[model samples]
Target: MTSNVNIDAHQHYWDPARGDYGWLTPDMPPLYRAFGPGDLAPLRTAAGVQRTVVVQAAPTVEETRYLLDLARGDDSIAGVVGWVPLDSLDAASILDELAREPKFKAVRPMLQDLPDDTWIAHAPREDAIERLIDLDLAFDALIFARHVPSLIEFVERYPNLRVVVDHGAKPPIRDGIDAGWQPWADGIAQLAKLPQKLHCKLSGLATEARKNWTEETLKPYVAHLLEHFGAARLMWGSDWPVLNMNGDYAAWHGAARNLTSHLENAEQDAIFGANARAFYRL
Candidate 1:
Protein backbone atom coordinates (compact mmCIF):
# COMPACT_ATOMS: atom_id res chain seq x y z
CA MET A 1 0.00 0.00 0.00
CA THR A 2 1.13 3.56 -0.67
CA SER A 3 2.34 5.27 2.47
CA ASN A 4 0.36 8.22 3.76
CA VAL A 5 3.48 10.05 5.02
CA ASN A 6 3.20 13.69 3.92
CA ILE A 7 6.48 15.62 3.76
CA ASP A 8 7.34 19.24 3.11
CA ALA A 9 10.52 18.53 1.17
CA HIS A 10 12.06 21.99 1.57
CA GLN A 11 12.00 24.80 4.20
CA HIS A 12 14.42 26.63 6.50
CA TYR A 13 14.89 27.93 10.06
CA TRP A 14 17.43 30.66 10.67
CA ASP A 15 18.68 32.66 13.65
CA PRO A 16 20.04 35.86 12.12
CA ALA A 17 22.18 36.58 15.18
CA ARG A 18 24.55 33.88 13.92
CA GLY A 19 25.26 36.74 11.50
CA ASP A 20 25.82 34.43 8.53
CA TYR A 21 22.60 35.47 6.88
CA GLY A 22 23.92 38.46 4.95
CA TRP A 23 20.67 38.71 3.08
CA LEU A 24 18.49 39.02 6.12
CA THR A 25 18.77 42.74 6.75
CA PRO A 26 16.68 45.05 8.91
CA ASP A 27 14.93 46.21 5.76
CA MET A 28 13.06 42.94 5.40
CA PRO A 29 11.15 43.02 8.68
CA PRO A 30 9.11 39.98 7.83
CA LEU A 31 12.21 37.73 7.74
CA TYR A 32 14.60 39.59 10.07
CA ARG A 33 13.51 37.66 13.16
CA ALA A 34 14.69 34.22 14.26
CA PHE A 35 12.70 31.22 13.00
CA GLY A 36 13.01 27.79 14.53
CA PRO A 37 11.33 24.36 14.89
CA GLY A 38 9.04 25.70 17.61
CA ASP A 39 7.71 28.40 15.30
CA LEU A 40 6.94 25.81 12.60
CA ALA A 41 5.48 22.97 14.68
CA PRO A 42 1.97 24.29 15.00
CA LEU A 43 1.76 25.26 11.33
CA ARG A 44 2.97 21.90 10.03
CA THR A 45 0.68 20.05 12.44
CA ALA A 46 -2.24 22.22 11.39
CA ALA A 47 -1.49 21.35 7.78
CA GLY A 48 -1.26 17.63 8.58
CA VAL A 49 2.41 17.47 7.65
CA GLN A 50 4.33 15.09 9.88
CA ARG A 51 7.89 15.95 8.85
CA THR A 52 10.06 18.42 6.94
CA VAL A 53 13.51 18.78 5.37
CA VAL A 54 14.97 22.00 6.81
CA VAL A 55 17.37 23.47 4.28
CA GLN A 56 20.24 25.91 4.69
CA ALA A 57 19.55 29.62 4.34
CA ALA A 58 23.13 30.76 4.86
CA PRO A 59 26.38 29.66 3.23
CA THR A 60 28.30 28.86 6.37
CA VAL A 61 29.51 25.71 8.16
CA GLU A 62 28.38 27.13 11.50
CA GLU A 63 24.85 27.51 10.18
CA THR A 64 24.80 23.94 8.92
CA ARG A 65 25.81 22.67 12.33
CA TYR A 66 23.11 24.80 13.92
CA LEU A 67 20.51 23.11 11.75
CA LEU A 68 21.92 19.69 12.67
CA ASP A 69 21.73 20.61 16.34
CA LEU A 70 18.10 21.54 15.87
CA ALA A 71 17.46 18.24 14.07
CA ARG A 72 19.07 16.27 16.91
CA GLY A 73 16.44 17.69 19.25
CA ASP A 74 13.40 17.71 16.97
CA ASP A 75 11.76 14.56 15.65
CA SER A 76 9.60 16.56 13.28
CA ILE A 77 12.69 17.52 11.30
CA ALA A 78 13.31 14.58 8.97
CA GLY A 79 16.58 15.80 7.42
CA VAL A 80 18.75 18.82 6.62
CA VAL A 81 20.25 20.22 3.39
CA GLY A 82 23.21 22.14 4.71
CA TRP A 83 26.11 24.01 3.07
CA VAL A 84 29.86 23.48 2.57
CA PRO A 85 32.33 25.74 0.85
CA LEU A 86 32.74 23.42 -2.16
CA ASP A 87 36.00 25.00 -3.21
CA SER A 88 37.65 24.85 0.20
CA LEU A 89 40.59 22.51 0.74
CA ASP A 90 38.71 20.99 3.66
CA ALA A 91 35.56 20.37 1.65
CA ALA A 92 35.81 16.60 1.66
CA SER A 93 36.79 16.45 5.32
CA ILE A 94 33.89 18.71 6.20
CA LEU A 95 31.56 16.49 4.22
CA ASP A 96 32.79 13.49 6.21
CA GLU A 97 32.24 15.33 9.46
CA LEU A 98 28.73 16.48 8.49
CA ALA A 99 27.84 13.07 7.09
CA ARG A 100 28.48 11.60 10.53
CA GLU A 101 25.24 13.34 11.41
CA PRO A 102 22.52 11.10 9.95
CA LYS A 103 20.26 14.05 9.28
CA PHE A 104 22.82 15.84 7.07
CA LYS A 105 21.24 14.51 3.92
CA ALA A 106 22.60 17.12 1.45
CA VAL A 107 24.56 20.35 0.83
CA ARG A 108 23.47 23.44 -1.10
CA PRO A 109 25.79 26.27 -2.12
CA MET A 110 24.14 29.67 -2.56
CA LEU A 111 24.72 29.68 -6.31
CA GLN A 112 22.06 32.24 -7.22
CA ASP A 113 23.83 35.02 -5.38
CA LEU A 114 27.13 34.50 -7.19
CA PRO A 115 27.98 36.68 -10.17
CA ASP A 116 29.30 33.77 -12.16
CA ASP A 117 26.31 31.90 -13.49
CA THR A 118 28.50 28.96 -14.53
CA TRP A 119 30.28 28.54 -11.18
CA ILE A 120 28.34 25.43 -10.21
CA ALA A 121 28.90 23.91 -13.65
CA HIS A 122 32.65 23.97 -13.16
CA ALA A 123 33.19 24.17 -9.42
CA PRO A 124 36.60 22.97 -8.21
CA ARG A 125 37.33 20.45 -5.45
CA GLU A 126 36.27 17.26 -7.17
CA ASP A 127 37.54 15.29 -4.18
CA ALA A 128 34.94 16.94 -1.96
CA ILE A 129 32.12 16.48 -4.47
CA GLU A 130 33.10 12.85 -5.11
CA ARG A 131 33.34 12.28 -1.38
CA LEU A 132 29.78 13.52 -1.10
CA ILE A 133 28.68 10.96 -3.70
CA ASP A 134 30.67 8.20 -1.96
CA LEU A 135 29.06 9.10 1.36
CA ASP A 136 25.67 8.89 -0.40
CA LEU A 137 24.79 12.50 0.39
CA ALA A 138 22.65 14.58 -1.95
CA PHE A 139 23.32 18.05 -3.47
CA ASP A 140 20.74 20.79 -3.56
CA ALA A 141 21.26 23.36 -6.32
CA LEU A 142 20.04 26.71 -4.91
CA ILE A 143 19.99 28.58 -8.19
CA PHE A 144 18.01 30.68 -10.60
CA ALA A 145 16.82 29.94 -14.14
CA ARG A 146 19.97 31.37 -15.69
CA HIS A 147 22.02 28.80 -13.83
CA VAL A 148 20.05 25.88 -15.31
CA PRO A 149 22.30 25.53 -18.36
CA SER A 150 25.44 25.37 -16.26
CA LEU A 151 23.66 23.10 -13.78
CA ILE A 152 23.14 20.67 -16.65
CA GLU A 153 26.86 20.64 -17.29
CA PHE A 154 27.61 20.19 -13.57
CA VAL A 155 25.17 17.30 -13.31
CA GLU A 156 26.69 15.65 -16.36
CA ARG A 157 30.06 15.57 -14.62
CA TYR A 158 28.55 13.98 -11.52
CA PRO A 159 25.90 11.63 -12.82
CA ASN A 160 26.05 9.52 -9.68
CA LEU A 161 25.22 12.43 -7.38
CA ARG A 162 21.57 12.95 -6.45
CA VAL A 163 20.46 16.54 -7.16
CA VAL A 164 17.28 18.57 -6.88
CA VAL A 165 16.60 21.99 -8.42
CA ASP A 166 15.18 24.23 -5.69
CA HIS A 167 12.13 26.34 -6.58
CA GLY A 168 12.07 25.10 -10.15
CA ALA A 169 15.19 27.24 -10.43
CA LYS A 170 13.20 30.26 -9.28
CA PRO A 171 11.12 30.78 -12.41
CA PRO A 172 10.37 34.31 -13.68
CA ILE A 173 6.76 34.37 -12.63
CA ARG A 174 7.01 38.01 -11.56
CA ASP A 175 8.18 38.83 -15.07
CA GLY A 176 5.22 37.00 -16.60
CA ILE A 177 5.31 34.04 -18.99
CA ASP A 178 5.76 35.98 -22.20
CA ALA A 179 8.81 37.78 -20.85
CA GLY A 180 10.56 34.87 -19.13
CA TRP A 181 8.99 31.42 -19.64
CA GLN A 182 10.57 30.06 -22.83
CA PRO A 183 14.20 29.87 -21.72
CA TRP A 184 13.33 28.55 -18.26
CA ALA A 185 10.97 25.97 -19.69
CA ASP A 186 13.38 24.85 -22.38
CA GLY A 187 16.32 24.65 -20.01
CA ILE A 188 14.33 22.68 -17.46
CA ALA A 189 13.19 20.30 -20.18
CA GLN A 190 16.80 19.65 -21.16
CA LEU A 191 17.87 19.07 -17.55
CA ALA A 192 15.04 16.59 -17.07
CA LYS A 193 16.27 14.65 -20.10
CA LEU A 194 19.74 14.00 -18.64
CA PRO A 195 20.40 10.41 -17.55
CA GLN A 196 21.49 11.65 -14.12
CA LYS A 197 19.25 11.27 -11.07
CA LEU A 198 17.76 14.78 -11.00
CA HIS A 199 14.67 16.19 -9.32
CA CYS A 200 12.76 19.48 -8.92
CA LYS A 201 10.96 21.08 -5.97
CA LEU A 202 7.41 22.34 -6.07
CA SER A 203 8.48 25.11 -3.67
CA GLY A 204 9.18 28.85 -3.64
CA LEU A 205 6.88 29.62 -6.54
CA ALA A 206 4.59 31.62 -4.27
CA THR A 207 7.42 33.99 -3.51
CA GLU A 208 8.59 34.06 -7.10
CA ALA A 209 5.31 35.38 -8.42
CA ARG A 210 3.69 38.68 -7.51
CA LYS A 211 2.33 39.09 -4.00
CA ASN A 212 -1.23 39.16 -5.32
CA TRP A 213 -0.68 36.02 -7.42
CA THR A 214 -3.22 33.22 -7.32
CA GLU A 215 -3.00 29.50 -8.03
CA GLU A 216 -3.89 30.12 -11.67
CA THR A 217 -0.82 32.35 -11.95
CA LEU A 218 1.20 29.28 -10.97
CA LYS A 219 -0.72 26.76 -13.12
CA PRO A 220 1.44 26.93 -16.26
CA TYR A 221 4.69 26.70 -14.29
CA VAL A 222 3.44 23.82 -12.13
CA ALA A 223 2.13 22.13 -15.25
CA HIS A 224 5.51 22.53 -16.89
CA LEU A 225 7.25 20.87 -13.94
CA LEU A 226 4.69 18.04 -13.88
CA GLU A 227 5.09 17.54 -17.61
CA HIS A 228 8.88 17.45 -17.51
CA PHE A 229 9.77 15.74 -14.22
CA GLY A 230 6.41 14.04 -13.58
CA ALA A 231 4.88 13.80 -10.11
CA ALA A 232 7.20 10.99 -9.04
CA ARG A 233 10.28 13.24 -9.28
CA LEU A 234 8.64 16.46 -8.09
CA MET A 235 8.54 17.01 -4.31
CA TRP A 236 6.45 19.61 -2.51
CA GLY A 237 8.03 22.19 -0.18
CA SER A 238 6.59 25.09 1.82
CA ASP A 239 9.66 27.36 1.55
CA TRP A 240 8.03 28.64 4.84
CA PRO A 241 9.30 31.96 6.21
CA VAL A 242 10.47 33.01 2.80
CA LEU A 243 7.12 31.79 1.62
CA ASN A 244 5.73 34.31 4.09
CA MET A 245 7.34 37.01 1.99
CA ASN A 246 4.44 36.72 -0.42
CA GLY A 247 2.04 34.30 1.26
CA ASP A 248 1.78 31.97 4.25
CA TYR A 249 2.45 28.29 4.96
CA ALA A 250 -1.22 27.33 4.77
CA ALA A 251 -1.77 29.28 1.57
CA TRP A 252 1.11 27.68 -0.32
CA HIS A 253 0.33 24.21 1.05
CA GLY A 254 -3.31 24.48 0.07
CA ALA A 255 -2.33 25.77 -3.36
CA ALA A 256 0.08 22.89 -3.99
CA ARG A 257 -2.59 20.37 -3.04
CA ASN A 258 -5.07 22.00 -5.42
CA LEU A 259 -2.48 22.19 -8.19
CA THR A 260 -1.77 18.46 -8.05
CA SER A 261 -5.36 17.36 -7.47
CA HIS A 262 -5.82 16.04 -11.00
CA LEU A 263 -3.14 13.37 -10.60
CA GLU A 264 -3.85 9.84 -9.35
CA ASN A 265 -3.80 9.38 -5.57
CA ALA A 266 -0.42 7.65 -5.53
CA GLU A 267 1.18 10.23 -7.79
CA GLN A 268 -0.12 12.94 -5.50
CA ASP A 269 1.25 10.98 -2.56
CA ALA A 270 4.71 10.82 -4.11
CA ILE A 271 4.87 14.54 -4.86
CA PHE A 272 3.72 15.44 -1.38
CA GLY A 273 6.00 13.04 0.52
CA ALA A 274 7.31 9.74 -0.87
CA ASN A 275 9.68 11.26 -3.42
CA ALA A 276 11.46 13.29 -0.73
CA ARG A 277 11.64 10.26 1.60
CA ALA A 278 13.14 8.12 -1.14
CA PHE A 279 15.52 10.86 -2.31
CA TYR A 280 16.84 11.83 1.11
CA ARG A 281 16.44 8.35 2.72
CA LEU A 282 14.47 10.10 5.46
Candidate 2:
Protein backbone atom coordinates (compact mmCIF):
# COMPACT_ATOMS: atom_id res chain seq x y z
CA MET A 1 0.00 0.00 0.00
CA THR A 2 1.18 3.49 -0.77
CA SER A 3 1.83 6.00 2.00
CA ASN A 4 0.30 9.46 2.48
CA VAL A 5 -2.60 8.84 0.12
CA ASN A 6 -5.09 10.29 2.60
CA ILE A 7 -8.62 8.83 2.40
CA ASP A 8 -11.73 8.75 4.58
CA ALA A 9 -12.46 5.00 4.42
CA HIS A 10 -16.12 5.20 5.46
CA GLN A 11 -18.83 7.84 5.07
CA HIS A 12 -22.23 8.17 3.41
CA TYR A 13 -24.47 10.33 1.21
CA TRP A 14 -28.21 10.00 1.55
CA ASP A 15 -31.32 11.88 0.52
CA PRO A 16 -34.10 11.10 2.96
CA ALA A 17 -36.61 12.19 0.32
CA ARG A 18 -35.76 8.96 -1.46
CA GLY A 19 -37.97 7.21 1.12
CA ASP A 20 -35.68 4.19 1.15
CA TYR A 21 -33.77 5.13 4.31
CA GLY A 22 -36.00 3.55 6.93
CA TRP A 23 -33.79 4.36 9.90
CA LEU A 24 -33.23 7.96 8.95
CA THR A 25 -36.42 9.62 9.98
CA PRO A 26 -37.50 13.19 10.79
CA ASP A 27 -36.80 12.63 14.50
CA MET A 28 -33.07 12.47 13.72
CA PRO A 29 -32.81 16.20 13.04
CA PRO A 30 -29.64 17.77 11.63
CA LEU A 31 -29.18 14.47 9.80
CA TYR A 32 -32.75 13.83 8.61
CA ARG A 33 -32.21 15.91 5.49
CA ALA A 34 -30.07 15.21 2.46
CA PHE A 35 -26.29 14.97 2.62
CA GLY A 36 -24.28 14.89 -0.54
CA PRO A 37 -20.83 15.50 -2.05
CA GLY A 38 -21.33 19.26 -1.89
CA ASP A 39 -21.83 19.11 1.89
CA LEU A 40 -18.74 16.92 2.40
CA ALA A 41 -16.33 18.61 0.00
CA PRO A 42 -15.42 21.41 2.38
CA LEU A 43 -14.90 19.02 5.27
CA ARG A 44 -12.58 16.94 3.12
CA THR A 45 -10.73 20.02 1.98
CA ALA A 46 -10.27 21.29 5.53
CA ALA A 47 -8.89 17.90 6.61
CA GLY A 48 -6.60 17.57 3.58
CA VAL A 49 -8.43 14.42 2.52
CA GLN A 50 -7.67 13.57 -1.08
CA ARG A 51 -10.49 11.04 -1.49
CA THR A 52 -13.17 9.07 0.33
CA VAL A 53 -14.96 5.70 0.18
CA VAL A 54 -18.76 6.21 0.21
CA VAL A 55 -20.47 3.35 2.03
CA GLN A 56 -24.18 2.74 1.47
CA ALA A 57 -26.65 4.39 3.85
CA ALA A 58 -29.77 2.41 2.89
CA PRO A 59 -30.14 -1.35 2.47
CA THR A 60 -31.87 -1.15 -0.92
CA VAL A 61 -30.24 -1.94 -4.25
CA GLU A 62 -31.63 1.37 -5.52
CA GLU A 63 -29.74 3.17 -2.78
CA THR A 64 -26.58 1.35 -3.78
CA ARG A 65 -27.14 2.46 -7.33
CA TYR A 66 -27.72 6.00 -6.07
CA LEU A 67 -24.32 5.94 -4.34
CA LEU A 68 -22.61 4.55 -7.43
CA ASP A 69 -24.17 7.32 -9.49
CA LEU A 70 -22.94 9.87 -6.94
CA ALA A 71 -19.42 8.46 -7.15
CA ARG A 72 -19.39 8.66 -10.92
CA GLY A 73 -19.65 12.47 -10.88
CA ASP A 74 -17.49 13.09 -7.80
CA ASP A 75 -13.71 13.07 -8.11
CA SER A 76 -13.14 12.90 -4.35
CA ILE A 77 -15.08 9.64 -4.15
CA ALA A 78 -12.47 6.86 -4.36
CA GLY A 79 -14.93 3.97 -4.35
CA VAL A 80 -18.21 2.70 -2.91
CA VAL A 81 -19.26 -0.09 -0.51
CA GLY A 82 -22.79 -0.90 -1.71
CA TRP A 83 -25.42 -3.44 -0.68
CA VAL A 84 -26.35 -6.79 -2.28
CA PRO A 85 -29.35 -9.10 -2.09
CA LEU A 86 -27.47 -11.92 -0.40
CA ASP A 87 -30.51 -14.18 -0.30
CA SER A 88 -31.50 -13.83 -3.91
CA LEU A 89 -30.73 -16.65 -6.31
CA ASP A 90 -29.45 -13.97 -8.70
CA ALA A 91 -27.03 -12.67 -6.06
CA ALA A 92 -24.01 -13.66 -8.13
CA SER A 93 -25.42 -12.01 -11.20
CA ILE A 94 -26.23 -8.86 -9.23
CA LEU A 95 -22.66 -8.72 -7.91
CA ASP A 96 -21.32 -9.33 -11.38
CA GLU A 97 -23.33 -6.39 -12.69
CA LEU A 98 -22.25 -4.12 -9.84
CA ALA A 99 -18.59 -5.18 -10.24
CA ARG A 100 -18.64 -3.94 -13.79
CA GLU A 101 -18.72 -0.42 -12.36
CA PRO A 102 -15.17 0.71 -11.61
CA LYS A 103 -15.92 2.29 -8.25
CA PHE A 104 -17.97 -0.61 -6.83
CA LYS A 105 -15.30 -1.79 -4.41
CA ALA A 106 -17.32 -3.77 -1.84
CA VAL A 107 -20.68 -4.99 -0.47
CA ARG A 108 -22.11 -4.49 3.03
CA PRO A 109 -25.24 -6.17 4.36
CA MET A 110 -26.88 -4.33 7.27
CA LEU A 111 -26.15 -7.22 9.59
CA GLN A 112 -26.80 -5.24 12.74
CA ASP A 113 -30.33 -4.34 11.69
CA LEU A 114 -31.36 -7.92 10.95
CA PRO A 115 -33.20 -9.80 13.70
CA ASP A 116 -30.95 -12.85 13.56
CA ASP A 117 -27.43 -12.29 14.86
CA THR A 118 -26.06 -15.36 13.09
CA TRP A 119 -27.56 -14.70 9.67
CA ILE A 120 -24.21 -14.28 7.99
CA ALA A 121 -22.86 -17.42 9.61
CA HIS A 122 -25.54 -19.76 8.25
CA ALA A 123 -26.87 -17.88 5.26
CA PRO A 124 -27.19 -19.94 2.08
CA ARG A 125 -25.27 -17.44 -0.03
CA GLU A 126 -22.09 -19.31 -0.70
CA ASP A 127 -22.39 -18.80 -4.44
CA ALA A 128 -22.57 -15.01 -4.05
CA ILE A 129 -19.73 -15.01 -1.52
CA GLU A 130 -17.55 -17.10 -3.81
CA ARG A 131 -18.34 -14.78 -6.67
CA LEU A 132 -17.31 -11.85 -4.45
CA ILE A 133 -13.93 -13.49 -3.86
CA ASP A 134 -13.53 -14.17 -7.56
CA LEU A 135 -14.29 -10.53 -8.33
CA ASP A 136 -11.89 -9.29 -5.62
CA LEU A 137 -14.59 -7.28 -3.86
CA ALA A 138 -14.49 -6.79 -0.08
CA PHE A 139 -17.13 -7.25 2.64
CA ASP A 140 -17.98 -4.51 5.10
CA ALA A 141 -19.54 -6.16 8.15
CA LEU A 142 -21.82 -3.52 9.68
CA ILE A 143 -22.20 -5.15 13.07
CA PHE A 144 -22.35 -4.68 16.81
CA ALA A 145 -20.73 -6.65 19.63
CA ARG A 146 -23.58 -9.17 19.66
CA HIS A 147 -22.91 -9.95 16.01
CA VAL A 148 -19.17 -10.52 16.40
CA PRO A 149 -19.27 -14.25 17.16
CA SER A 150 -21.44 -14.90 14.12
CA LEU A 151 -19.15 -12.71 12.00
CA ILE A 152 -16.18 -14.71 13.17
CA GLU A 153 -17.92 -17.89 12.05
CA PHE A 154 -18.75 -16.38 8.66
CA VAL A 155 -15.14 -15.30 8.14
CA GLU A 156 -13.96 -18.75 9.12
CA ARG A 157 -16.32 -20.20 6.53
CA TYR A 158 -14.71 -18.08 3.82
CA PRO A 159 -11.25 -17.20 5.05
CA ASN A 160 -10.29 -15.46 1.84
CA LEU A 161 -13.19 -12.98 1.72
CA ARG A 162 -11.86 -9.57 2.73
CA VAL A 163 -13.89 -8.34 5.73
CA VAL A 164 -13.78 -5.15 7.76
CA VAL A 165 -15.59 -4.62 11.06
CA ASP A 166 -17.23 -1.22 10.87
CA HIS A 167 -17.12 0.85 14.10
CA GLY A 168 -15.14 -1.70 16.14
CA ALA A 169 -18.37 -3.67 16.41
CA LYS A 170 -19.85 -0.54 18.03
CA PRO A 171 -18.74 -1.09 21.65
CA PRO A 172 -21.13 0.35 24.23
CA ILE A 173 -18.81 3.10 25.38
CA ARG A 174 -21.77 5.34 26.24
CA ASP A 175 -22.32 2.97 29.13
CA GLY A 176 -18.66 3.34 30.05
CA ILE A 177 -15.88 0.76 29.63
CA ASP A 178 -16.56 -1.20 32.82
CA ALA A 179 -20.21 -1.70 32.03
CA GLY A 180 -19.95 -3.50 28.66
CA TRP A 181 -16.32 -3.58 27.60
CA GLN A 182 -15.49 -7.19 28.35
CA PRO A 183 -18.01 -8.73 25.97
CA TRP A 184 -17.13 -6.46 23.07
CA ALA A 185 -13.43 -6.60 23.84
CA ASP A 186 -13.34 -10.37 24.11
CA GLY A 187 -15.36 -10.81 20.92
CA ILE A 188 -13.22 -8.33 18.99
CA ALA A 189 -10.01 -9.91 20.28
CA GLN A 190 -11.18 -13.25 18.95
CA LEU A 191 -12.02 -11.61 15.61
CA ALA A 192 -8.54 -10.10 15.35
CA LYS A 193 -6.96 -13.49 15.90
CA LEU A 194 -8.70 -14.92 12.82
CA PRO A 195 -6.22 -15.86 10.12
CA GLN A 196 -8.06 -14.28 7.22
CA LYS A 197 -8.49 -11.06 5.32
CA LEU A 198 -9.90 -9.15 8.28
CA HIS A 199 -9.70 -5.53 9.34
CA CYS A 200 -11.45 -2.94 11.59
CA LYS A 201 -12.38 0.70 11.20
CA LEU A 202 -11.41 3.27 13.84
CA SER A 203 -14.64 5.18 13.25
CA GLY A 204 -18.01 5.84 14.91
CA LEU A 205 -16.53 5.58 18.41
CA ALA A 206 -17.70 9.09 19.25
CA THR A 207 -21.32 8.37 18.41
CA GLU A 208 -21.26 5.19 20.47
CA ALA A 209 -19.84 7.02 23.47
CA ARG A 210 -21.32 9.77 25.59
CA LYS A 211 -21.99 13.02 23.75
CA ASN A 212 -19.21 14.65 25.74
CA TRP A 213 -16.66 11.98 24.78
CA THR A 214 -12.99 12.94 24.59
CA GLU A 215 -9.82 11.38 23.24
CA GLU A 216 -8.95 9.93 26.63
CA THR A 217 -12.39 8.34 26.81
CA LEU A 218 -11.74 6.58 23.48
CA LYS A 219 -8.07 5.63 24.10
CA PRO A 220 -8.43 2.21 25.69
CA TYR A 221 -10.74 0.91 22.97
CA VAL A 222 -8.58 2.29 20.18
CA ALA A 223 -5.48 0.92 21.91
CA HIS A 224 -7.06 -2.53 22.08
CA LEU A 225 -7.65 -2.50 18.31
CA LEU A 226 -4.16 -1.20 17.54
CA GLU A 227 -2.64 -3.79 19.86
CA HIS A 228 -4.54 -6.63 18.22
CA PHE A 229 -4.96 -5.68 14.58
CA GLY A 230 -1.93 -3.40 14.38
CA ALA A 231 -1.82 -0.32 12.14
CA ALA A 232 -1.72 -2.42 8.98
CA ARG A 233 -5.17 -3.93 9.50
CA LEU A 234 -6.96 -0.92 11.02
CA MET A 235 -8.36 1.95 8.94
CA TRP A 236 -9.74 5.39 9.75
CA GLY A 237 -13.26 6.49 8.84
CA SER A 238 -15.32 9.61 9.51
CA ASP A 239 -18.74 7.86 9.66
CA TRP A 240 -20.00 11.38 8.81
CA PRO A 241 -23.52 12.86 9.06
CA VAL A 242 -24.28 10.20 11.67
CA LEU A 243 -21.24 11.68 13.32
CA ASN A 244 -23.20 14.93 13.47
CA MET A 245 -25.28 13.24 16.15
CA ASN A 246 -22.35 13.65 18.56
CA GLY A 247 -19.59 15.46 16.71
CA ASP A 248 -18.60 16.76 13.30
CA TYR A 249 -16.17 15.44 10.71
CA ALA A 250 -13.28 17.66 11.83
CA ALA A 251 -13.80 16.81 15.46
CA TRP A 252 -13.85 13.05 14.82
CA HIS A 253 -10.86 13.26 12.52
CA GLY A 254 -8.91 15.28 15.07
CA ALA A 255 -9.80 12.87 17.88
CA ALA A 256 -8.68 9.90 15.82
CA ARG A 257 -5.38 11.64 15.02
CA ASN A 258 -4.76 12.43 18.69
CA LEU A 259 -5.71 8.92 19.76
CA THR A 260 -3.15 7.51 17.33
CA SER A 261 -0.44 10.07 18.18
CA HIS A 262 1.81 7.53 19.89
CA LEU A 263 2.34 5.51 16.74
CA GLU A 264 5.23 6.08 14.32
CA ASN A 265 4.43 8.48 11.46
CA ALA A 266 4.27 5.69 8.91
CA GLU A 267 1.99 3.57 11.07
CA GLN A 268 -0.31 6.54 11.59
CA ASP A 269 -0.36 7.12 7.85
CA ALA A 270 -1.39 3.50 7.29
CA ILE A 271 -4.27 3.77 9.78
CA PHE A 272 -5.31 7.12 8.33
CA GLY A 273 -5.34 6.26 4.63
CA ALA A 274 -3.10 3.62 3.07
CA ASN A 275 -4.75 0.66 4.80
CA ALA A 276 -8.16 1.86 3.62
CA ARG A 277 -6.93 2.42 0.07
CA ALA A 278 -5.50 -1.08 0.05
CA PHE A 279 -8.51 -2.72 1.72
CA TYR A 280 -11.09 -1.10 -0.56
CA ARG A 281 -8.77 -1.15 -3.59
CA LEU A 282 -9.56 2.55 -4.02
Question: Taking the tens digit of each residue's C-alpha lDDT, what string does model 1 give over 136-157?
Answer: 9999988876888888888898
Clashes of 2: 0
Question: Which residue runs of candidate 1 sit more than 4 Å off their true CA positions?
Answer: none
- lDDT for model 2, on a 0 to 1 scale? 0.91
Model 1 clash pairs are: none
lDDT of 2 by residue, 122-159 (tens): 88389999999999999999998888888888899898
Candidate 1 accuracy as TM-score: 0.98
